[model samples]
Target chain A: MAGMNMISAAQRFHAYANPARFMALSARLLMPLAALTALLTGAGLWFALAASPPDYQQGETVRIMYVHVPSAWLAMMGYGVMAVASAVALIFRHPLADVCAKSAAPIGAAFTFLALLTGSLWGAPMWGTWWEWGDARLVSMLVLFFLYLGYMALWATIEEPVRAARAAAVLALVGSINLPVIRYSVVWWNTLHQPASVFRMDGPTIAPSMLLPLGLMGAGFTLLFVTLLLVRMRAEILRRRVRNLRLAQAGGAGEV
Target chain B: MTRAFFALLARDLRLAVRLGGGGGMAVFFFLVVISLLPFGIGPDRELLAKVAPGMLWVALLLAALLTLDRLFQADYEDGSLDLLTMGLLPLELIVVAKALGHWLTTGLPLVVAAPLLGLMLNLPGEAYPPLILAMLAGTPALSFLGAIGAALTVGVRRGGLLASLLVMPFYVPVLIFGVGAADAATGGFAGEAGRQSLLLLGAVALASLVLGPLGGAAALRANLR
Candidate 1:
């Protein structure tokens, strides 16, 4: 409580603004994080495929739940991370935050696409349709996917990194507002998709036996995202260094 | 300030008109895109009429997107953008004036030409008024929103495509509501549809009016630097 009051999230954020410090911290945590990610994902897949019982209705096909749900969760989570990182880049002018936000785009896009693909595969058997436009969650997820693509495309198309970051930051912030609307559009409008069952006011509807695997899969996916994020951040740091080195060499040549 | 705004607006309009093909290209592009749709879906008049309003709206949106690059590119290249950015007026007002110019050149001409295209596509009579109304209320939002993209990609080598890519996603809501309103009208629910969609379109235009210029100004500054 004292720590929370003493140092706000913004101030705490400033502490890691320095790229060298961030790189060092990421490097230190990388090994353990990678191990945890591998271990959890391996175990989660085992439980998901072998341990969790088939749904009474969905049968074996419901196994897609483990992958689909986690990917969907991460797609939204990735956007949340992007929005915060973009805000950090804009307000605090943190260099690492820009790198964090920029590097996360393609990864988030991949997650979104995976969620859509997996959801479609699941939908084929359960809903007896490959796609349903009336499902608000599904439509919103598609929009989210496009947003991810646009964000990445904005970055790739721009020649200047700083300008790209700024433009993409504005986009990221704007797109973040849609996340909740997407989540609730189903409830607000009568859609074909079911409402929240796992994270609702009344508590989770799934039995514990099924819940265990879902929870594990969720944890595994979260760990996997963090691991991938750290790797991407490190790669960006190196790329920035290379760019700086090239600029320095050019400067030296001009001086000569 | 008002004089400067009008002067700038008039100048841009004149320049666009003088360009010979600026206004016509958007209309032509709209026609071609809509024309291609029937071939792709097969020439069933009933289907075409059913989908015509949405198709026209989508084509207009894309046409507007395709031409958005011209919103600032010519001025940026010829140093007029710099003058406008550095001039005494605030950037937001200049943006509004520029957007007005854009609407006059691209959007207004599209609206004028849409009814003709509607006839070609056999759009139902009931759909025509709402289509024009939606376009009138909505295309300004496109110009305003597209201005930000135009400003962002103003000086890029192949900015036209990039500008489209950057702006089209932002254009989605406008496309949705514009087409939705047209669909409602054609489905005999025009009176029941009220002005909610139009209001939302206006809200988008208003929001873009505020943010568009700041973005444009920032992008302009970046290009100049």
Candidate 2:
């Protein structure tokens, strides 16, 4: 039954919350994840730039959409992942949750930065301005970027890992709740940005030609997030191991 | 439980007033910030009047930030927060009490002082009532929401700046509706233009009232662990 399969899936998730298990699993996943990411990136880029037709109105500047839209989606997606990790860390005391959340911050920030940069570049040609405050999506994205910065800053400011993890988890949850409010506020206020075209109530308004490139680029970016997260989480685990080893060595010398 | 809450509230109020320069520092900062705006923006009375709602709200937010670190940091530093956490009353009540104390001390004064500052900015006479009403309805939300940031950063040394960075984004909704309400009041649109924004501001305040204490308490407990 489907319910039995769901239970097993939950079991697998809980099993991997163990750091040693997570380390071994992620090591296995990393190679395939990286290979898939590279393959997707190459194919996605080729299709987006070479195969997909340019926008009738936007012309070649629309190529930026291949990068911009996907990065923006990943930026939001990355925060969602961090928020879930925080929730898991708080509720289950999962050993790997904090590491997962912490490792994702810089990657999220980078994607957010890329989204903004590509957005500006796109806007400069299309809208005849480098930036537009009247755009709700852009403004909301900016706020999201600031949230990432604040989250990272909190982690840096606190010296104790346990204390920092808890505080950051609480913050991440609060930010997640506030995200909708921020988005709503921007939308309620005046915005010059075009309304949603891809994700709509009935169906996507975008043409299939544009949609194909967008979909491929989205998948590629998501794979990259997975590859980067695994690598960063592994590095974090090793750093903790080194710190623990150093402490044990110091304790041994003191015993003499 | 109610008595315990009130007692904690009173204790925080007294401490903020007595030791922390009588909660006047925030109002003073608010005053100074308003005074400096004319110099920076070049003293155009019309422009000042036009932007007064936003300027006042932004200054109020910054002034509120000046006092936020004091919300939990003092108790945190003196080991009292740990004791409070272990006390009979729940940590959530303590958070509510502290945020209420912050509102009473800092937020109320800023609301009280806004009309006077509004005059210097040449804010239209019709705008004053809504502006005051908006601030009164909205500021408790700021205090409560800010307490969460204060609690999160309480374990860090000299975390005042980080607290502001963490807390200010949360203040955006309040700022938007607060400014909107003031604008509606001044824009002279007929049939309750200002009323809608004020009502929305109240809704946001209510949501924050429920969420802030819970979130702040959770952060405090986490830090204590």
Candidate 3:
């Protein structure tokens, strides 16, 4: 189902990719996406704060899951977005794929920073320590954060647009291995962090009370990411257009 | 095809020895880093002995990382990389050859020198063989993985620092298992944990052997284009 959704999404990306058409479609998308994000965020907050019962063991502190878990999930998902777009850029030579990959990097890095910050926040009361060196998941996630910074640095250092895109595309593809490592670190080591309860094989172990709010928050975060992504991609396109125009003007001036 | 690969390998090996300051500088850098640890961390013999394995692996990583940009940047500047790319041998194979040359020059010397330096830290007598074994198995991975970053930033000016930043994250797992294997010998070399660490370290090196060439080749092509 995920694979199917990705293929269709990629098709939509390839279909109306003429920049003028994309701008029109994305402008239409912005308001609806923002509205949906707001709606989900409000409902999710209400349920998480008021409706969801506090854990008998964890008390009110478990509520941090509303922010922490979703941030972690979306952080990984953002990397997936970058990797997939990088592949499209490399293989299909889709005009917008590099833009998409470039746009996803800072947003993904922000989410990763959020995940680490919230995880540290959650850990303070839960584990009695702000950080745990013993935990593989935390360590791997830290590595992922650094990887994101490095990927962005690569793009920044390479001046030529085409060269930067291809070099960064390759780096993104290589760093994609981090996704699986972070996902499985909890399962493989099972250190201080709790094992994955929601995405398990025997069905979600959590009761209906908390899962509902978690799902809502997760949906809200995904929508927010897509919204932010569209805004950033539009900005990148405009930036490139401005650069090209300046170059053109300078060339004409030199000729005159 | 095989002849071309070996020729490239031989040429690189020669360059490393004759033109690129040889592998002597990396070993000397390794010694300096190891020597500075006592001053930096304070002269606590017990602590130095305890943390020697991890410290040694770290020094090895830094030394190898420092030399990585030289792998392709020289050929790139001299326009020889273009020749290799145009030759009959695939770029992936060329990457593999250069990576091997890198390992032979840099990684091998460090592995040989690691034991002598361990003695400076009052390292456990039992740890020597395991430390050598671990480095022997793991250091090639550092070279191979470093090739990817070297290739990525090949055409960029003064890209050594950037390549190091990019390659450091990829070096984590290798460092973990290498230090694990080297340190575990304290509990007796026969411990199951040491064996597992060495095995995993080897597995990582093998995986990098495959992935390194492929990624490095792709990055090289991108830069060359």
Candidate 4:
């Protein structure tokens, strides 16, 4: 009975792993996720742009933090998502995991790009420089951006899906180790960027006025990422089906 | 097992030496890139000396990149890589041996050539020891990390650019500490800070020595599959 129960549990876990099952689940959740993302983002931006108090030090320029900081958070968070999904794919041979990992790369890369662009915008007002190569956060974030581009490029280069996924998994796992070293090494190398303001051991130095909208924006951006990920995964699954179908019609080869 | 590993390593070393397109080519590339810099930046010795550590290091890096794809592709194309997978030698150990061979042939020669290139960049005398030492400690990490990239791209035709793209970002920490170690000495602070960066550079080398083989083996297995 215990063995039977375990077998049933495993079956149920894998039931959700089916691409059709994933598509059904994502279809149901997508509207809700997108709606919530829109609502939170709307309220958050209103507060961020209008209601939040200006930093005494930064004045109006601190407003850029609303868009910049959340995207930065989401950008790194996106890579974390990719790396975790890649790990699951590698270990369990879950088709959904590969789809999820592949989908997350472009979204993560967009967020990284946004973070860098907004960061340069913020730097211009604050540091009197459009870009600061000496800044650790900037450089590490730039590295992280390239890592995303590289991951996506690997997927594009390998014609076979399984080969691409596995090779990308290796890259992602290796990147997980390298990311921290890049972060720390840059810090030790030189640091012109400001030290950690929020998420400090001493508690966030920013006022509650800023923190609330920032939280709202962070949560909103995360949901947006999730929504986008679901959409991309759906498209990828459909694309693969079309591919398999074409191959079948031509010569009856490939896994369906 | 050790004998098998060395045999493979010896074979690669011989191929790199006999072919004359590995170490010799990299040094020549190094020389050309360094020469181009003086034209781009003008003949200002003061500026050249100021930028020498970084300039030489970057040139060495790009030169190493020029040879990265051939690290695994030759054997892969000729079916030797398939034999390697079936051999008594573990794939991870094969990876390490191959990376070691690559370092000896390509990376080490670049280290030797960097000082000569550094002279062209007007590198200060005080910076030379730390520059060489930092690179000596750092370039092995490059070869090892490059092994992972090379392995992933082994099966793809004209994968050299893709391999460099995937690999160069990981070279950041190495580049940072390497330049830091050299610059710390140039600034006359070699006692404390320079030692710290060099130590960190060595630490990166050591870490890559382990992680590279694991990653390279994983990638090679994936490509073979």
Candidate 5:
């Protein structure tokens, strides 16, 4: 009960509602977060490559899992962030939420592409085929990549910022429903892909030795996502500020 | 609402027909695309027949998309969209009417011309009925959903390409089901495939019937601002 209360209570943490406050908070956290991300990533990569043993059957190619798994996780996490930010923007009209969602898109898209690329590389070595449409997970992820591209394209193509944000919000909401569909499509349909092992009712099938590096990489990649999101958000805010300043200067000149 | 709906539909149809090369442009574009495909893939009757249903459906989709922009573009530009919005009639009815106009000009003509092109590709003669049936069930959904994209991009200058980008992803399920139904008919599984695809298409169309107008109205309002 206490845990449930705590979780519910944390949901009200709208501290970043104000853009200036959010920027200040993000600026202060950026350097420390960047350092932590680098350190974790370095350690994670070393552990993934050297410390972890190769799979009994798959051998050295199992190393691809380090990059592929984390990136896949981050892809979903990025969409989660966007969806939550959009909800906040829609319900509370938080200005920062819109910026957060917009900035997160390109970063998410890059992560999704990375996941797909690494998955393909990994698949080629193990499955003996470069592409497999029968794999529901693979196909769903491809669809997701397209959806991300479409959402970002919609944002880029629109001239008005607020209108673009609103439209993108709708797209984000619509696309988020697909995430679950993608996750389950493999299991529900008898596809070529293997079923979930790491996440299931039966706890993880991975041994602790491999699990350690995998967990480390997962954490490292999540931290890296935060760092990139902050950097992009700062850039977006600065860009908007410059535009506002230019508009204001023009307005003053008109008054003169 | 019924009276206003028919009024708006009639007005849009008249304007679309009266516009220089309006309906003809979409038909010509469709014909040109169909004609070019045979040139690209050297004329092989067997291969053409095999791929005919998909080819005709894709061409029809592209041609239908080509004219969807005009559904609200003229009204949006001339401020008639605002007039419609401010009138006593609901925007949903107006959206349905506009979609009907879009279909009358774009989809109906494509359906009429599809049989001739299908014959050129040597599609089995029996496939024509289901092809037309699928389009009859499917194209309304395209018009309804495409209206949302058109309304979303109403005021933008280079909105045509963006409209296609925004609308094409939504069109995938329609394309899948429409072509799947036709393919099933060719493969002699028409009873199951045709029913399922048409049913799914109808469900999508019905969903859009409610959501499309709301989305279109919101987009139009956003553009006005």
Candidate 6:
């Protein structure tokens, strides 16, 4: 049964590798995904804002973690997806992979911006400063924010689609190498900020009461990301098609 | 192959010296940036001393970036890069040669000028050697890493700013270690403490020296196509 499932999964992937099929499949999935996103996010917010207990030490301000942490999570998650998509685009030259990467940049940048803004909001009350250079995680988030901006900027600056994708892919791969360094630089330089709590080796340190809400929020954000990615990818595919059509109309110029 | 490598290196070095105020402009920009910092932040020498190491590294890094536009733009525009790409020498070697030339003309001057700027900033007497040493160890990595950004942005119009944006984040590790080494020396940590940061700085440079050329070569191939 497990082997049969794997074969079906592969077949599905192969089928959707075609753009027309992908458009149809994503269009079908979009409504269900959107419904799930709304359901999960509404529940997640209720649990986070109303049900979860305030922290013992941080009091009410700790409530900010729900919005802040999940956004940060989505920010990094979005970049990881872009990097993987870029790698696939580079190695396999898949048309969908290029669209996947290009469509993902702005979304990743938005999430990264949200993470920075929400993190600052969380920090102002908790850390007593609006910003702290001594905090490794926040500092790394800022660097990651810049990385996203550069990636998007590269895409915007290049006019040719294929050339842009290849160039942006190289930049994406190189920038990913620095992501870990940015994460660790504070430790190497001696951090004044808190160590990681949720994603630790020995399990999260937060209470179960808070953890459940955080988990729901995380799932909701991820589902929302998937919904948005499908929407954007479909739009990008259509945009490229329009460009090809226009080019063809203009004296049946060069190949698309 | 050996002779061709050195020949490329020699040719790049000659061009950097002969044209466009290459070495002098970068060092002068480094000096101006550091000098302007005192006015912007005030001339409280103690505060200046406190921030001096980091400021020096930041200035040198920017100075190196300013010179990087010339690294490939000239060769690219003159059609030599296309010839080089099609030539007997590998693209990675050419990247390495360009980075080496960039270091000699740009990185070396910053290393030499750092101590003078260090004095102007009222850096502690004990900090001078480590500041100079750290810059010496770290600036080569800037050139090498900057090469990848240069290659990636070569085909774009007015790509100098974009290249810096793409490249600046990568400089974080180098900055951290470079400043850390100087701070360790000035803070009077144990005898080996400063050495550790220096070693790490060297390690970063060595790693960049190896990986940067390959990445830059790949970017050049992609962008040139």
Assess candidate 6 and give its TM-score to the true structure. Answer: 0.52
Question: Candidate 3, B14: how far from true, in Å?
Answer: 42
Pairs clashing within candidate 2: none
Cα deviation of B174 in candidate 1 (Å)?
27
lDDT of 3 by residue, A1-256 (tens): 9878877766776776967777888999999999999999899999999998997766787788788788888888888999999999987667788999999998988988788777767666765445433345554566677668778767866778899999999999988865576447534544333334322111236667888999999999999999999999999989899989999999888865
lDDT of 2: 0.83
lDDT of 4 at A247: 79
In candidate 3, residue A23 scores what lDDT? 83
Go through the candidates in order and give each one's DockQ. Answer: 0.03, 0.03, 0.02, 0.03, 0.03, 0.03
Q: Which stretches of candidate 3 lie over 4 Å from their true place?
A: A1-15, A181-204, B1-225
TM-scores for all candidates?
0.53, 0.52, 0.51, 0.53, 0.52, 0.52
Query: Residue A125 CA error for candidate 2 (Å)?
Result: 1.4
- State in Å the error of residue B216, model 1: 33
Stretches off by above 4 angstroms in model 4 are: A1-11, A191-204, A253-256, B1-225
- Candidate 1 TM-score, true structure as reference: 0.53
Q: What is the docking quality class of candidate 6?
A: incorrect
Q: Which residue pairs overlap in candidate 6's backbone? A: none
Q: List model 1 lDDT by residue over B1-225, tens digit each.
A: 888889899888887776545666787677667755654664445677788888888889888888788788888788887788677888778878888888888998899988866764667787877788888888888888888888888889999999889988888888877877777877646556636676676677677777777787677667667
What lDDT score is found at residue A194 in candidate 5?
38
For model 3, residues B74-187, the per-residue Cα lDDT tens digits are: 889999889889999999999999999999999999999898678656677888888899999999999999999999999898899999999999999999999889778887
Off by over 4 Å in 2: A1-16, A191-204, B1-225
lDDT measured at residue B224 in model 2 versus the true structure, 0 to 100: 76
User: Candidate 4: lDDT of B131?
Assistant: 91
Docking class of 2: incorrect
Clashing pairs in 5: none
Candidate closest to the true structure, highest lDDT: 4
